[model samples]
Target: MPITTEPHVAAKPALTTTVAREYVHRAALSEVLLTGWNKTGRDAFKVTAQWPRSHSFYVSEHGMHDPLLLCETVRQASTLLAHVGYHVPLGNQLSWSRVQFAVNPYALRTEGTPADIQLHVTCSDIRHHRGMPVTMSMHMEAVRRDCLLAVASVRFGSHSPAVYQRLRAGKGDVNEVFAQAPQPPEPVSRSTVGRLRKQDIVLAPTPDRLRWQLRVDTSHPVLFDHALDHVPGMLMLEAIRQAGHAIEPARGGAVMPTSMDVSFNRYVEFDEPCWIEAEPVETAAPSSDGRRTIRVAALQSGLCAVNATAELTDTVSL
Candidate 1:
């Protein structure tokens, strides 16, 4: 879809009116509501948003729904009240300045499909320092039933008086699209005692530099107690990340990897340690807001176990 920023319209309430008739793209909301997660008109200060299908919103090819896109959805939903002249003062504004998600592994599989989901988000506080206005804090949890799928938080900045006027006039140059931020280099940490170990260099990080070592312990989760067996793909990625951290500080300011495409070329089993060497195929660059992307590759035991690129940013709040 071409980029769009529609002008805000006022709404009116009346007797004998349908809910859909009172909202934008009611059909879309209807589909989302069918997923059984919406709670509309339940509270004077709260509202709900939902989608029936993953395709209803957006999904990426790397085996998961794009986290950045979901974050954007939450931002838009939260600001809908302000745009629709709810209790918020006229000209009040909110833009997602940061967001982060710590996701569960099993939920990772259902992400590409239209499974039921709900986001419970709350505004914790807002404050200002000197003349720089800052909206305090807000957190969101994506859940199915009582199980937590993901936990996220965001920070927003209210618009200034002049900026709000421009927005109302439909001439605002503001873009809520967050630009990716430069990912910080992974941090250095102590090495754990393990059966297999090797050191290598990482050329590409969301930040300019990254490097680390690969230590393998097939015994940690002994499959058969014979050999280490093939290392789980996710575990390998985790090891790569650990190695990367050795080169620099963990990208604390970075939005954790929302999705990853990994190709397993071979396996690193228990008895043998897999040494991985990694580097960025591309350098990090500025994204909307303060986010960034980095492309990286890894070699295990001289064999390419996984090769992939990752998008990273610090704009996301945790």
Candidate 2:
């Protein structure tokens, strides 16, 4: 089958329905954010998505869409492009290397209805194998009815089943590893993590006060929609979000993410405790709008598994 790259055109409303769950490697249709995509030029695409006003997992932060939702949208859009644009097989495994996203806080404000988004994505640094894409990075801007919502990037490796099996040698059985995943630890306070439910909190208190243990709940409908041998990237990303709130002084329980730049150095196994730590990067000199930067890391097996730097702000310009 050949995937065509036609010139860009206006998005069709009829294509607004969520795409197949498998296209983005998600288990549930609700987890799918992308509506559709059209190749605009070589390595360029236009992808459409929707952000519901109310979501159980990606809840609103002070009436604004969750920044991690933007990250998820970018992840899904990029993955979808990998499949339709580059013809990557659904059986292939995608190991994300990095995810970087920065959203315009003002643009995330929810109106009286759901938000429709259009992303202009361009891929680069592509590596091919046997005529199929092996790895690539996507840079895109998320727009909402002409308002720019976010700019993001995602880099991942596409591995065939054989290569993935070799990579996961011992943990190749996803179902077994998923079922064997450790029980989630007691979560931090809802107010502390800016979450309403204990299940949504991804951090457990530690003796150090500044550090927390990563909470992995395999039963999570959204995060663990479908299971795998290793801890998924999105879970680690949520850990960073909780840690950021834990590090900040609570004020009206409102702090939305402005940006997040993260890199995955190694896989976070389901069997170990990954320590999450956060430190302020720019505490003394805050931005005019009260934005602050924080550095967060996930450590496991005495090694850094993931690292991220993110910006936070309390105000959402409506």
Name the top TM-score candidate.
Answer: 2
Look at candidate 2 and tell me the lDDT of residue 146: 96
Assess each prediction's global lDDT (C-alpha) against the native.
0.41, 0.86
> What TM-score do all the candidates reach, one by one?
0.38, 0.93
Worst 10 residues of 2 by lDDT: 282-291
Residue-pair clashes per prediction, in order, are: 27, 0
What TM-score does prediction 1 earn?
0.38
Question: Cα lDDT for residue 208, model 1?
Answer: 28
Superposed Cα RMSD, model 1: 20.4
Candidate 2 residue-wise lDDT, 14-85, digit = tens: 524788889898988878888888989988999999889988999876778888898888888877888888
Model 2 clash pairs?
none
